[model samples]
Target: MISNIMTMVRKELIDAARDKRSVMAGLYYAIGTPLMMCGMFMLLIGQMTSPEDLNIKIENSDNAPDLVKYLSSKGITHGDSQSTNDKGDQLDVKDIRLVISDDYAAQMAKGLSAEITLIADNSNEKLQKSIRRLERNLQTYSAEMGSLRLIARGIDPRVVQPIKVNVEDEATADSKGGVILGVATMTMIYAVFISGMNLAIDTSAGERERNSLALLLSHPVSTRNIVLAKVFSVTVFAMIGLLLTLIMSKISYAFVPWQELGFTVTISTEFILLMLLIGLPIALMAASLQLFVSFMAKSFKEAQSYLTLVLIVPMMLSMAASYNIAPDTLQWLPVSGQQQALIAFIKGREIPMLQLLLSSVTTLIIAIGLTLGMEKSLKSEKIVFGL
Candidate 1:
């Protein structure tokens, strides 16, 4: 049985290699999609880091000279209160303003709140973060001022605040690596499945539609051997596509400005090895699933539709995994389990060896069951008749 499967695998590899269109389709999907996604993400990162200037308005200017000076020192220019027309048409300022009321100190002393309006172009995303930062800084400054006022009354500033707190993180480098690895793993999984779709369909349903599968099955090899060969061929193409995508991702990361993002993305040797170790079995399972679906399909178009559904499973699993849903009873679910295991590895958490073993076994069991079913179908006259 092993020798027969190996022979079939060799035949499938040769046939797949000879098919230029399948090769091209796999290359385009894996390599093209990642590059496009990376470009869009890099553009978003660029927009996030760019400096933003805002326009603001202060209502009462008389009592907030210190606040106004602070805003000016921060390079934020403010607008005058009288700039509004009778129709309430306010002249737009390029930045925010600090308004000080006559009873500002008294209002604060009584624990009453006064409102300050921030007016700026909200359309710019970068400017929004800047506005938020300014607001937080102002809040901190006000707290400090209140503390100084208490000290003047011979009260220790610490007396008013009963507790002080600080945060310490215990995350290791591997765990940090895991966060990034998770996304990459998900992306690679999607790419591999998508890239192999055409090859799997063409090898099975395409051959059936073209009236070629019947002739191939009539060869000396058993129907199971034929199915194994086709699946092996599809897996090889998928693996190649995945490897290309992995290489391209590393190359793209090298060009990205990590320092500006405040985190370095070093694709370590362990990450690459772990990705391969985890990704290989998943790819095999994907290839097997596609081949089974394609074999069950009546025509190339039908296979295409079925393959679309198959491809969606991984993406949906990935989306679910992103919500940090714990591995409960649902985690044992096929694609979901694989997603969780990959995520665990990516997060630099110690992957439960049991989960990995179980996922691999489950995928293989499903693949073997499908292969057996396909083998049975192949022996039928309806399959040979291309019905």
Candidate 2:
């Protein structure tokens, strides 16, 4: 029985390998997605990191020469209309303007409040961080000036405060990159579904379309053996694709500027081993699910369409885990559960062993059930003939 199933598995793999469409579908995703993600992270890190110099428009500079000097000391200064950095690169200038009131220095001399207007589009997300930095500096300068005045008057500057608050952050660098790691891990989880999809559909519906399924089913092997063989073949393809994706991710992720985010996704050797360990059952479930769906379709195109809709369930589960939309329940679900575990591992946290075990058990159960259903369905002439 084992020899017969191995023979069937070898044949299915060889046939699938010959199908360029099946091979390329897995290759493209396994190779392309990680590189694409690296490029996106590079762009994102550049945008997120603060530049060495911040340049904005400062109106009525003479009215607040002292204030302008204070801002310059903080690396916030006015810029030329066509400003360039030391490297002659064009500066990323926020369109923020600071307008000093005409009587700004006079108010300070009279021991009264001074006024300045911050002008910028508050709705612009790109400018929000810069604008807030500028506001914080201004507030700090104002508080310093007030404290100096109180000290000169023989009064304690602490008189203005009724409460003192000190905040201590306990977040590790890995914790800061949780969102990015979650997204990265989600892509790896999805490889299981995508890498084997084409082969699964082709082996089932494609076989029927070519009028070969009936002939193959007529052999002496049991339907259960045939189902197992097919599932194993598809799973081999899925695992291969997943491993390729992980390798690509491990290499490509090294180039990303994760330090700017105060954390990194190293794709450690241990994590790779864990992913492969956890990904096996997912690959099996994915293979069975795809084959089961494809076998129900009358033709290759119909199977593709059905699988598209069917694959969404796993994708949604993975997405929920990635975005942390439903962690409580998804921790025990198949794709999402494994995703959360990988994310936890990346964040330098302990593995959720119970959830991982439950999800793995559930995954194997689904694969077995689907394989059995395919076995039963293959025995029905109406289904075998697509009647």
Candidate 3:
């Protein structure tokens, strides 16, 4: 049986080698992540940071020229929506309107509470940070004026404050941006699924469509051996893709300016080695899963569609793990559990060996279950002969 499986695997590998493009056909983002991901990450970091020149509509600038000048000093300036530049391009204007009270600075001269109304669509997600920034600046200006008033009256401004709060971050630089790294790890783990999908589909449905499956089945071999051979071949191809993904990550990660984003990510040799070792079971499960789905379809295109939808299960699981969502439950799930373990390792935290072992066992069991299913299905005339 072993010899039969090896022979079948050798033939399939040779066929795959003859068509390199189909064999290396990538999953999606991870495959093209060499340089594109770096640029994408740069954009993400920049967008997440607070903008420098905050522009908004000032309704009554004449009422408080002092406050308007203070705001302008902080780069918060009035902007008209219809304003244009030298090249006739529209200016970057926010829809926010800041309306000062019509008291003409009387409240401030009388040492009374001043009123400033900020108007904008609070529901606009893009303006949330900007609005908060404006509110903080206004509070700072109010506090400063109050402090001056207290000094003029021979009182200390600190007398009114009872407690001060300070927070210190204790996370190491390596572990600062864990969520981003988790997604990066997810992309690497997913390499196994997409890398072998084409070959898995071709080996099963493509064989049936070409009338070669029946001929292969007629040979002096058990269905178990055939199924095992297909799984092995696909797993091998998938691992190759995974290894390539790690290499690309190791190469491409250096180009990203992680320090500028207040974090650090290093794709060390140890991480690459560990990722490959961890990805083996995932590759097996992915291979068996893909082959099992492929054998159930009537055509290559139909199998492609089925597997595309089916792969979303693992993707969502990994994404949840990446974002640290529902970790208490996901930490025990199959794909997500293994991913959490990987993320922990990356963060320099001790791996939960027991959970990882249990997750690996469950993953292997799933692989075995799917492999047995493929064996049983390959014996059916409806599947093998397309009846």
Best by lDDT: 2
Q: Candidates sorted by lDDT, descending order?
A: 2, 3, 1
Q: Work out the TM-score per prediction.
A: 0.74, 0.90, 0.87
lDDT of 3 at 47: 65
Instruction: Report the C-alpha lDDT of model 3 over 1-387, residue by residue, as the tens digit.
Output: 688888999998888767666565953434586456667777766665545678899987988998899999998999898877568978899889999988748888899987889998999999998899899999989888888999999998888756655778786555547767787888888898888889999999999999999998998889999999999999998988888888888888888888776765778999889888888999999999999999999998999999999999999999999988999888888889899998888777899888888888889999999999999998888999877
Runs of candidate 2 exceeding 4 Å displacement:
47-54, 73-75, 121-133, 260-263
Question: Candidate 1's error at 37, in angstroms?
Answer: 4.9
Arranged by TM-score with the best first, the candidates are 2, 3, 1
Alpha-carbon shift of residue 25 in model 2 (angstroms): 0.9
lDDT of 1 by residue, 170-197 (tens): 7554444443444556677676686677
RMSD of each: 6.3, 2.5, 3.2
lDDT (0 to 1) per candidate:
0.70, 0.91, 0.86
